[model samples]
Target: MTTNAAMQGKAMSVEEEKIQGGVQSLEVGLTVLDALTAHNAPMMLKELSEVLSMHPAKVHRYVVSLIRKGYAQQLTDGRYSLGERAHAFGVNALKRTDMLELSQRYIQDIQQHLNCSIHVSKWFADGAVVVQSLESNHVFNIITRVGSRMPLLKSATGRLHACFQPEHIIRPLLEKEWESSAKPEQYPANWEDFLELKAKILSQGYASVTGDMMAGINAISIPVFNFTQQLDHVITCIGTEDQLPEGQMQQAIDYVLGVQRQIDALFHPAAAI
Candidate 1:
């Protein structure tokens, strides 16, 4: 890890919420944000509290803080709304993605050496997946257009980390994902199969598809970890079988793993910071 990254990544934690003395301020804030994001509009304190199952008094404290911090604001009617600060934080957080930027160098190297398409991904709140970045030898391709929100069960990139990453690491998220909007048919199989795939992916620590999601697209994906090296995002190499020749598939996997190690180095606190 670099000296600067160590200082920045210090802010990263596995708690999944803002640290507090048994009080999850971040969770409460997200609950409110979730309601707003779901409704696609501002919501009153009563509506937000009802949706979040939190008391109005407590919700008001959070709403007030959010307003002060600029993450949220009050409307003319006194309802809560996402403030411009929320978008600013998003854009700022995005700017810190040395991982995505660094990964592209590796992506280009892999594509040129392996002669295929390669990409990186980061998990979004739900349904949609962010491509983060992508590189390809082919002038035009169908795999993971940049900024595209990939379906959880539909894309190889989605399944790569979604299923393969450990439940201790992936569960709260997968559950939160389903809770947000679950239509089992999205995976194109029975519920039982989804469970089975979860097991298969976890056991294998990776997922590959000869033909799934979009037809004629072949992709192999491996999960990437955060500072503690827990599975969080994924790095995938995509290519048509026609473009892949002989042992190139295995080579691509080996290459991606190597790149993952390099990417991982940047996240480790000791070296990164």
Candidate 2:
């Protein structure tokens, strides 16, 4: 129901606001890059200037800076595309932001809501290592410190990592830990039982431990998948039977699952599975 004059007025107002609030040269330079991005391919100077409604000389000036700063590349064929630095900037940005750092807020929320100790662990070359934690107010003495490395076959966090990891990556570490932990009997005598436990953890999207890693400690762990749809971090809720109780176990699992889903949705909506 709007007239052409009204739409013209709105467009002019937006342009006026942009010119008033933004640096003129920077805006023009960015617009040149924007045109290239929209085209999503190499473009000749005349084509770019025609699309942008600007003189070729002015477009060349902006493209020179873009190429110098590595935001855009001029190919040997005289066409342009996004430069290596532009692509690396995006990948490095994702790398610099740590998963545990983002999950800390969620961990604190879980602590406040459940009043149970929480541990955040990430997979390393060897195994899962605890990186952050919130102690339960009840405080029944937790021995696993932040730097503690969890057992692959025994601990909740380790089991969750093991469940999602390929066998080639986890098998050697498990064999090494199993040989050294001095708990030979604890390693399922039948290899199939271990496989079944892993299958169950993967199927349930979480794993539970009842005093396997540490005596009197019962914990549940859920994996957080990154944008690559690979398990990158694990969050474990820790408590004893006296604190978590048998009847409330599933409730705790449900809570941890909810937390994992929120993190997955927030950071990797497109990769969510």
User: Each model's TM-score?
Assistant: 0.49, 0.66
What RMSD, rounded to one decimal, does every model reach?
Answer: 20.1, 11.9
RMSD of 2: 11.9
What does candidate 2 score on TM? Answer: 0.66
| Model 1 ranges with Cα > 4 A deviation | 1-97, 164-188, 245-248, 265-273
What are the lDDT figures for the candidates, one per model?
0.67, 0.81
lDDT of 1 at 199: 80
How far residue 238's Cα lies from its native spot in candidate 2, in Å, is 0.6
> Model 2, stretches more than 4 Å misplaced?
1-23, 28-92, 180-187, 271-273
Scored by Cα lDDT, where does model 1 land? Answer: 0.67
Candidate 1, residues 53-114: lDDT per residue as tens digits?
98999888888888898888888988788888886875677456655555567667766876
Q: Against the hidden true structure, what lDDT does model 2 obtain? A: 0.81
Encode model 2's per-residue lDDT on 113-188: one tens digit a residue. Answer: 8777888888888888988867888857454688888888888888888877787987777777766767668844
Clashes of 2: 0
